[model samples]
Target: MTIIATLIVLGVLIFVHELGHFMAARSVGIRVDRFSIGLGPRVWGFRRGDTEYVLSAIPLGGYVKMGGMDDQVMERIEGGAVAEEEDGAAGEGKVQPGRGSADASRTEAVPSAAGRRRDSDFDSKPVWARAWVISAGVIMNMIFAFFAYTAVAAGWGSAQADTTRLGQVVVSFLPEGTEELEGVPEGAHFTRIGDRAVEHWGEVREAILDAPAGPLTFQWDNPRGEITVPMPADAEERRRVVMGLRYWVEPELIFVEPGAPAHRAGVRAGDVVVAVAGERVHLWSQVQDLIRASPGREMEVVVARNGEELSFSVTPSSVDGITPDGEPQTIGQIGVQAQNPPITYTRVAPLEAVQVGWSETVFVTGFILNFLGDLVTGQVSTRNLGSIVTIGEASGQAAAEGLPVFLSFMALFSINLAILNLLPIPILDGGHLVFLGIEAIRGRPVSAEQRMRWSQVGFFILLGIMALALGNDFLRLFGL
Candidate 1:
């Protein structure tokens, strides 16, 4: 299931990206030769007009072969026959969009003679035209994301976190044994977080949720001192474990995820938590601790559905996770979020959804850019780097949840794909843009030698990143 979901997701994103380039090229009169899906020798395809549309050996990404372009690095990346073009144009490889041979027996031609650069050739086009061709993929990905987000918003409504309301500020989590927190009560108010005066939950997300994983100090008035605790890097765990803001929290079940232990045990949203394992519980922290302590153990959960209390048996599932120590360990999971005192999910009109979608698109773009900057500046750990394995796992999980959730995940991933391609590294869409920019400013292209040298550097950098991400994935998989 994971593999299938991953493939489908990747295939859709890749197709949209490459299709952008293909359409842009044709619009600018650039004759495409080979339209290959994947990155190796032609597996199957048919010729149409001047392009030969074929499926290739590798099933990762697609490419198009355009006239008057020499992609040595791409050819090197793809290897073998994919590098050899029909017009003796060797080293003309595309990453996910490239060219091909036309049928001479029919009536179509290559759009020009094989020996000379034609007016329809990509190199013969204006700088703006070439730029359009190169950047179309990224643009399309962003557009796809926008539409997907808008659809989700229209269908399921946007999930706006309640930032103003305060509940269980300290009871959600209390660092026991810390000298400063020794006298602090369970429901004590927190005045500050990381030098920021947090009057509400908004600032908490910025100070703790958005901050990189590390030892962070907290001060409560009751204790009148500070205690340092390690924080998780991921957002999901940070909400539940670090902040204790789970739904069904506040002693009321606001959300009960389908197929989760709680839901399977017949728990539903709006159920007031009465007890767990027959032990009376009021604080979400106590509930979390109880559930965490009883991994894979069947226990009774009591909730107030109406005027009377109801009980159901649920067994917590154990999964690999981390704590403040950063060491991998088994922890119990019930798959739920919090329900505050009150909650609502109001579906928006199409127009409002569009506005919401645009806002989300811009916000996500900025957030990803900021995160990358942090990564470059060493504010975030490299251990957060993930590979295809992590994405596949997430794909499967999201799909299992439901369609709207799956689309939401896909939208986020598509935006990520677009942004990553805009990085100024060679061989990527961003790198080509850099080349074009240099050409436009200097009135000449960067010499092939220089381009090749930088491309090699870029390729190695990508290889290193891939290795690191794969390593992290394996470590997580094996509970390292």
Candidate 2:
């Protein structure tokens, strides 16, 4: 299921990218010979007019082949416009060629039709037009990412930390294992941590962690009312006090396992797990800890349903798993999903979703660029790269976790794909554009030999990256 889902997601991204190029080429009057989704042997395709649309067996990547353009035609087209034609000879009411007028006229007349056809070809288009055509694929990708992110943002409210100043007392999160508090929520806001006016969650956390033996005063606001809660005298006793609780900050759920413990426990879509076993479990780790400690034990589960607290008796199923700390443990599991709280719609307007999406797209692009930069600078190990296998395992893990996570994964993967295709490597849209830019500047097409050599290098580099990514995936899957 995970593999299928991953492939589908990847396929959609690839299609969008290729569609961009196809559309751009058509817009510029360039004939596309073929537009294929996926690579290798053609599984299915049909010729429509002058173009063949195909879906290949291997669903990895895709491409667009243009007519009369060897991908470097942009330079030729732009430079050809400014080319000087030989002077014609003076004749009676007729334009004549220069010194070798007779010979030149004979040569030109022979290939007049062919020359006209070539002049109207893709390479004969203006440099800017050619550049636009080549760049349309990446532009479309960015636009798609923006829309996807916008839809998610508009559908689900955004999550904001409780940093808004409502009064003199600010709410903040109190860290776990603080001797001053009992069980404050992980992201609770507070006014004072043992006599200090706390503004940020980090400040509150630090104060609690560094507290000497004393009662901690936390002024906070709850859905019911605002109140000040005193921490326990023993600092060690109240380490995990979270003060300001935020709910439903993440968006919708994307996956749900059939017949899992959650399925049997009456947990359904759009339900938020407000509390587990009567303890506030805002984060997955908190819920995980409770389940780990109470495997096969029935506990009270409180869910937020349409702004109401609904109760259920949920039993954690026993499962063999490894904790984040790397300890092998048999733990309780419920095949249920918790709703990701949508960002507060009031905080951001519907149109702003586009901005959010664009921001996310830019962020992901920068992240990939940085990663590549790190690879070059030796800041990050190249061996840590990933391939399809790694992506599949990641998808599997997200599916196993729940729906909200899977949605997030899709978002990230979409952004990643969009950014990767923009790299200036031959055979990629970016690579083609790079060559076009050089040709436009050089006033001549790059030699076919030079283009082929650079393309080979780019292909090998891409292959190397894929191999590393696959290796990383295997290592992660087997816990190497």
| TM-score (all chains, Cα) for each model | 0.63, 0.56
Q: How much is the lDDT of residue 354 in candidate 2?
A: 70
Model 1 spans with C-alpha error above 4 angstroms: 82-113, 159-167, 170-345
TM-score for candidate 2, residues paired by index: 0.56
Worst 10 residues of 2 by lDDT: 99-108
Determine which window of 10 residues in candidate 1 has minimal summed lDDT. Answer: 101-110
Please list the residue runs of candidate 2 whose C-alpha ends up more than 4 Å from where it truly belongs after superposition. 69-120, 159-218, 221-348, 396-408
Residue lDDT tens for model 2, 274-343: 7888897656546656877787888987777788877878777665554433345567766554444332
- After superposition on all C-alphas, the RMSD of every candidate to the true structure, in Å, is 11.1, 14.1
